[model samples]
Target: MQPQSADGASRDPTKVRRNLTYDQCYYHPAPLTRVHGQDVRTRSVRRQARIARREAALPSSRTAVSTPASSGFLGSTSYLSVFRETPRLSKAPDRSLCDEFEQWRTKLEYAAARVVRLASAIPFYLEQIRWYYDKGRFTVIPAPIVLDSLSQTVAHMESHPWNVTGNWASIYSDLMAATKSPLEISPNTSARQFNSLFTGPHLRFEFIGFIFAMAGLSVQGRFPGRQSLELGNGEKMDTDAFTTEMVLACHHCIEVCKQNSHVNDLTIWMRYMHILLATEVLGEPSERVYSLFGDLTSDIYAMGLHHQPSDHVPFFLAETRKRMLAVSHRTDKNLSTAMGRPPRLPHRYCDEALPLDLPDESLFEEKDSLERFLQRLDDGGWNRDGKFYPATLMRMRHILSNLREQVLELSLGRSTHPNYTKDILATYKFSQTIFNRIPSRYMYTSSCWKEMDAIECLARMIVRLEHLFSVLQLQRIRCQENSEATSDLLDTCLEVLSIVVDLTGQYNIHEIKKQFAWIYLLKPRSEVIRTLSFLVSWVRNTVTEAQPSVMVGACLELNNVIFKLLDDALNYRPPLGSGQEDARLRSVDTGQSFEISIQGTRGDLPSDVFNIGLASGESLSWLDDLDFMQTSSGLSLM
Candidate 1:
């Protein structure tokens, strides 16, 4: 078969090609001048000598390449002797196929490397932030110093992202190029060298693990810290910072692999989701990640339907998805799983898992880094991009759908054998653990929402299941009761359903409303509040005036709905547009003031206790009134 060039044109048919062996391949760059060429060559000799010494370590009669020396120097002329003949062609050789695959693999390896390299940096950064926080000096660190450090780090990472991409691309090109030559490789060849190129070396696999750790640590630094700051400031909700940097990173990785048609693109993309999911749990959600996830989900289905020849790719994607589900489950069981199931744990994010009593470390590090990054927001100046940042719900819909398919795959025992229910529960439970760390109330901002996406989703899901189960109970109770009780329970159940249905159906939330906190995102907070208020007033009116048992039943239903709503509202951070100042605060009296140290504690005690006392002696009374129980108990208990 004629060879094809890089651009897919046929190679000159008249030219005689050299028959290259694996050894000759390395020596092609005569007098190899790469920076580590000599060192690498020297290492090769040592490896070969060790192999010879431990010939007993080698399997008997397995294929072995003969390394030939030229000019008294040894090199990587190694190969599996079994593949001496050219690969048997089931179809005519399409030489360019080698070139294409080579290009794809090279890019993929680079993307993977970027993720890996970032992994290497995480432990260092995490430690740095925690130290400062412990000293009560995280925020006190000069912003400029932090900026300088970040600028350097980000720049270095940026430069290398492409570098890694290029290296992987080159490796792929070489591999494909090798495939086209008479240097045939066997499917079952016991060549350790060959396996390194495909599955990667021990370090490479370690890099993958490192990537997972890095992703987890990225938010660990910022999430708890930011929440702490916000709580101290009396802001109950954390803002979502699923910023452009993260979105762009996901985009670059996913898009590069897609463009190059990288074999492991799906694997990298799936791993990337773990980071995104963690980020989302922390409060910021990545539109690009979510969008890409949707596209990938659809692509998987398309491949399955078409019986696409890219079986290996799909298999990797599925496996990656499973791995992600597994990692996320580990992060927090009570956090919502991608699959809809009961949460196993009550919370997902916390500091307890860190070196003992280091709850403030993640937060301290994140704030140090983020505040610096945030300062740069003004460098280029802000300009609204005349487009809506898509609501996170759309992304969740796609993710949940993919998860559903995965669950089914397990349930039917069609793909791999595993317990579907157990897996789902595991993920759900893990997510819940993560959510438990998020401060309740408006102490966190919608801007920091990415940190708790998984947690918020878990909370929402919990609320949902709780609602569903309660509704079912209500229905059963209704069936067993007299008409009055039955009517009351039925109404209550419907109200619960109405609220849940509204929350679940936010698939196409309005553009303006999309950015709100999870609680507000459940439904228009105003509408829900209004409906609730009217329901309560109606009940109050009934209590004062004579009404039929049916009306009394409606009142019971209304009361149940109010309780559920209160559980959600009082429990969740206020929505983004709620326009409610986090009532949590510390106040300085007009004539008197006090100083307090933050000391990295995670609560509103300092701010609340002080502020209320300062605002007025009556402020303490006001605090008592803010409790939901107190608010509900007086006169309008319904």
Candidate 2:
């Protein structure tokens, strides 16, 4: 019988057993004691005493090596020397520590930047609230309170050295909870209590906070650069850094809401609002935007906001629900129209009553006051005031939603539903009536248009543009067979383009070019693109000498405006490159030379005239060839 060596090679078993001490055989105590047994209990006791004495006699340096089964032995290691070796565990590398420290430092810098950026913009936001209030814009009461809180927060950040990080869930939750109008009555609350709540400051400061935060984020995302002038007293602000911090802060706020298992209406609305800004204003084509939009619609349905508010519902809350619903509907409609997809929110599902055409001040009044106002409105006592802008806009949006549905139906070849054409024409006429109902004071007439405030003018233009768009869309369907209808549609499209061009001229180009700066302007600009594309295609296909000159002129004007608007909408900044003649440049130069030659030859015709003639001729020639092919195919079939 052989004993095993250190590397597991066979050795003399008897000799190995003889050499093994009681301490080394601790795991096999029963076997060793049995071999030396006189009385089993006494032998075991003796073996244990000997093992204890051997352990105590070991040097302090060897204690770690000699200690067996600290974690409880799974198997005997008496023959293995590997168990005696102590391996020192090294600390983490300096590079790893440095990297972590660097990350923390960067985060701190970003936080500081965000605080400064938010603080600097606080004054501007406060002034905006004041201005909106002064102008009778529908602002919540807690706007001032939220503004104060923001001011204090900014001051605290400035006064201290802090690294603000994490989800900020508590702050977000607190702010959102504050925005709920306390005047809101459940089915259980008394009417008297509700009335008292309504009269008190029930302005949702959470909403205000959300808007400010989102606005800060938007501003930061749009303008990432250094200001030429110093901020405050010689503070050279790094706007780009500030913007980065703001983006992170906004993301944190959103993430906090998202991480919650249950999202309330306020959070849902805030999230939806952010998505709108991201998609429409920021022009971010993220898939998350669409996903968030889906979630928003689901939330709206869950809250039952698609249905009309019951009489028991508070006026402020009802109005808020209606506005949120309207915004959701409009967002869905616009996105569907743009993407050529069916709208997520169907018009039939949203049968909520149109928002009241009353001032914000009227909303907080007693139930009786609102009931009486509704009675008057029902009896054809609607007032035409600038304050009605929001209600009017909502109504117009509803109409546009219907228009969009009709357009979708037509495009999908589902227009065979009876009286489709009549319904469309009726809608067009109704839209016009709505536009005409806007107070003459708010209307933009050439003589007194300049007298109107920019905001009011923008509102008027939006209404007019929407009406024109509806008319154009209606006429477009009929234009396939009726040249007269085609001509009418073309005119409507031109009017749309003209209105857009006029609106663009009214605003400072710099302001218009700013990211998400003028959301109202996007709708008209989009309409212009749509209308121009249709008109250009029509003009190319059809040859009409009577209005060729007029059509060509409109096309030229629209082309120029479209290009400019596109540049602005895309925030296009030209790259710094060498002025080299590429193929595209050479082609453009050749085209110009040809145009000059034609202008010289045709003294009566303008360059545009020649260009239009050539383009239309080519299109007409292509159409003729197509017709000839159809006729030849028909003959062959016969």
Candidate 3:
């Protein structure tokens, strides 16, 4: 049941304006220092506290240096407390709904919400997608439709693509200019028509809801002061407001498809047939996704999925368990980084091999087929001809996660403790070795994407960005006087930022990346982006008389560039004062503890954001680069 417009299309798509939290926001960048809902000054306090806890957990430093006389009859266990399970202080459990939602409108309120999270058959994962799109019943694609639309769009565009020899807007004029959906698609659509269809609104709401919004809004709308919600005047579809809004719009659409709201067998059968004709696609917006992640990893240890399965298990079942362990391990590291916590599944305790790199087809086929597939695999067990198998990325992710865990452990360790490893160079070299050892076939380049399908290409790009990002992240902690990263590392960091900006500007990759934005390093959240931005801060903060880093010159602009890129990407201009209300439901002193006037804007504080003072009387030629000017972009983000 949808509300109809004068044209008879539905109107409920306006729901995108509400429920911003249920989906990830692409428009506003996440907060840098206060992501964990802590004061900016408390980051170091938490790190020190985390280190203190670890030190208290272990035996004293005296145990490592026991004298021969002291060692006689005096063992390491002499001072140890007997192992015991005791009740400890616990914190309040986290709730997904606000204190308000405790007032559920009958069980139907929860029944409707639960339908989106659990009862839905469609997955939010990349491996499977919304396969059942229908015209009025279901706006997402039908189960039978594959990559035909993508292929047809490829056919519409000129062969010279922007990623290669041309940009999408340059080769096609209508990219930022479309005003209407076509009655029909064209292999030879004019530049204006194509751009309109390309950057213009696609139906993002479900069935009736989606149909109306696409008609009304590139996402046109009104603001608090009657200011126009303007799209950028180019092929770039990177507006933080629009992109973030559309992402939420898509999240709900996917939920509707997954919940199978139609709830019947005959309709699904008919929808499958209609896909032979056409289809479109999108997530519910929820921070609860991460909350659910915490629940999942906790349950993993409960179920002993962290350990290898019994030897008696079948190959498929054993492999599936192994794969889950690997993915969860990697996911834990990422979540810990963003949340400023320790990883749940540390690599040192886990004992299991990566899942075999075989496609799903080979596993389901006859026994000989599985064996033949195994025999043809490369020495490293990679699929031949750079083929993509589900396990291919999984295996790589496991290996990388193992290294990432170690890196994070070192970064969070008690460096001042006597037992801490002093050999930082060794850790640096180990990271390099692991990164280099990645399978050559998994290396990604936009040019080589022609050989593989979209998922495989996107997967390769994702892993590569992750590899580079982790390297820079490790550098932030280790890039000190004696163990500095070379200029090449800075080059890679710069490349990462550029690629991220360019990604927001592109159509094809941007759409795919937005779907799983919360997880992917390329589509990394605020905290991860800060790691890249703060590399210069790390270099400067180092207490050293050692020669200034070669990167210091380039780093002068790093702060502004990083903030600008993110500010534009996430449309992250939040309210200035602690008392001011955030458009987002979150309540972090997210805007920082700024003192503001009666007006919503800043008054006491100057426009200059960072107040940096150098100890030495060096000429700061790039002082102007640090000017943190605020943009006019609206505030709406995850």
Better of 1 and 2 by lDDT: 2
lDDT by residue (1-638, candidate 3, tens digit) is 33345577433221222323323321121111123445657654433322231112211112132111111121111111111111122211121222112222232322232222211111111111222221122122222222222233334332422321112222222321221222333334332342233221321113212221231222221112122332311111222223222333333333334433222211221222121111111111123344435545555665466664545444544555576677767767765554445677788777757777776545444568778888877777677866666677777777887667666666555567564455455666777788665667677654434566555656776776777666665555554322334344444554564344323323245435444455423332345456655664664574233536433333344445555544443553534773334422132123222221211111222111121111112212333344211110110000
Every candidate's lDDT? 0.31, 0.43, 0.39
Candidate 3, residue 369: the lDDT equals 72
Best by TM-score: 2
Q: Tell me model 3's lDDT, rounded to 2 decimals.
A: 0.39
lDDT of 2 by residue, 427-512 (tens): 55664566454445545443323566555556566666655654655565555434445446545654664454354344453433
Give the CA lDDT, 0 to 100, for residue 29 in model 1. Answer: 9
Q: Which candidate order results from sorting by lDDT in descending order?
A: 2, 3, 1
Q: What is the lDDT of residue 514 in candidate 3?
A: 47
Clash pairs detected, candidate 2:
2-13, 3-11, 3-12, 3-13, 179-204
* Model 2 residue 422 CA deviation in Å: 6.9
What lDDT score goes with residue 88 in model 1? Answer: 41
Worst 10 residues of 2 by lDDT: 90-99
Model 1: residues with Cα > 4 Å off, grouped in runs: 1-244, 263-275, 278-290, 299-638
**Model 1 lDDT per residue over 245-315, tens place:** 12223433344334432233223333444345334432222222233344544443333321223223322
